[model samples]
Target: MRNMGGEQVEEAVASAVALLRTATERDWETTPAGRLEWTCRYTAEHVAGDLIAYAGQLAGRATKAYVPFEITLDEGTGNEDVLQVIETTGALLAATLRTTPREVRAFHPYPYRSANREGFAALGVAEVFLHTHDIAAGLGLAYEAPAGLCADVLARIFPHVQPGADPWRTLLWATGRGDLPGRAPVTEWRWRNNLVVPAERLTLQGVTPAAATDLAAGGDGGFAWVEGGPFQGTRDAAGMLLKAYGAGVHRPEWGVFVLVRGEDGRAVGGMGFHGPPDEDGRVEIGYDLVEAARGNGYATEGLRALSAWALEREEVTSVFATTDPDNTASQAVIVRAGFARVAGEDSGSAEGAEGAEQFAYELRG
Candidate 1:
């Protein structure tokens, strides 16, 4: 997947500003922005404010809440001046994205409490694209963002939304800004940033569908991996994640997570659930580490953290795993993570011949 970062933000801001400039002489203060109660002028200001706010979030390294501040234009600012503010703020956000570390996360309250640099960049682009569309609609002007840019934003932040034939329209519909064939109009929506869980020596970074697609296609999934890392199992898991996303049943938190080392920010392994908890409140997990990263207990620490995170949820009563009988290293990792080996029917041995040959383990809440 393409990295939707500073360049994309700059591109989006430029496109929006160029188009809005055409209508600067029009009555923006009185014209309502499409589907929004705010007027075109106010909406333009909002776009600028969001851009700067995202920049602030990343630059300040805020973890608990928003940096309590807001931008206000000078009294009697003109439409052209508003556009200038948008440009300035967009540049600020782009610069911030370029400098923020990959592992750094800051406050953002949507489905998750924090967002990384890419997440903030995606949000910045989304704000510019959607709100620019609104302003264009109100002014009776034409506007459409680049299809690739639209797809990039969707894959990163709108992972829950099934991709449509037209990414731009899908984005519009997903945000309650437009409609689609055979699908009910969206009345409420919130973009989701991928989840991150911290362990003793690693962070389990949730893989977005975009990253999953790239990884499945032999790409790096935007992670810096240790040499000989992201083994075949990680790619296979990413393929499974893409399949679930295509089916519109992929719950991001239940999808694949790349194990990133805290000290150097390099991905060392992959670990995640097969899916959400079943009706019996049991969720199965799988994991693997690169040969170069193994024997250091990274897998054990990651498994312990991820399993505990899952078990803490009200719907999950047990976390399950199964390993090949000959894979003693993996068995040790599981054992170290507090999973107990199980036998008989409770071990899922009756499921099939395959199940009987593997060692089943469970960590109960």
Candidate 2:
């Protein structure tokens, strides 16, 4: 539900691979996107290739920002190559940790608004930690993430670290969350959406669950989160999220659901419903979209719809959300969704992750 573990990330990819495999025998070539996105086999190959490519980056002569190097997903190359890339890269980083003096600084080519010289260093540490851990998970192998080894990098980065600030923000002038550079960072986690919609335009009417579909018909240019409709999830899951919103739960108390639909009618993203609809109808909201579909007005739309749905109940008084202060995009969405800042929150260390600082927002009776 939070930071993915190696086992979870691997399970997710395995599921995706299974679906892709079944579709293959049927002669289906499209990715989950339903388009001629990378073929099923190449899709796995590319994922492996992408990892190798990242490892190659850390291994290359260019330590500073540079164009990404290429890695082949050729059939001739076995998965062993992908594993080797990871292991080899791990060895190099380990050596760097043991030998390189902390003062000799280096950087990679990637964007993270929150990433400064110090924050970037944390990101570098996170990069190696996350990717190495994830690849092993994907391959049913085990490995250790010596975050302690890069203690110098962490120390430099930790000071500049604002709670909830992801590595990308530190690395790039850009804001919002997305994938990292030179690494596949996840442990059995299905990467979710990175929506960062503006809050100014978050109007109740504009975010009805069905708005995305209607807009596609009218050809509106802005962004919005459409309903992924009803969904089912593993028991470990609270509701219809994390698995592309598969259908199952549709209780009236569930309120509504939505996805981030681009200008096209296709639902490429999703989020909404903070909890079970209360007797008074109070409920919070959330959204998850893809890497490509971020920074549009989707999160705002989802918030609007959740509010609209809750407001329908006269007994309902308000709704709220907690987010990282550095996650300005999410905060913006919260404000625009008809909630207001009312209180402070505590964002503690990794142990008290949920304790991090949060802004409280509420709607009137």
Best model per TM-score:
1
For model 1, the superposed segments whose C-alpha errors exceed 4 Å read 346-356
- For model 1, residues 62-169, the per-residue Cα lDDT tens digits are 999999999999999999999999999999999999999988999999877999999999999999999999999999999999999999999999998888889999
lDDT of 1 at 142: 95
Stretch of 10 with least lDDT, candidate 1: 347-356
Backbone clashes in candidate 1 total 0
TM-score of each: 0.97, 0.31
Q: What is candidate 2's local distance difference test score?
A: 0.38
What TM-score would you give candidate 1 relative to the actual structure?
0.97
* Candidate 1 colliding pairs: none
Best by lDDT: 1
lDDT of 1: 0.93
lDDT for position 159 in model 2: 21
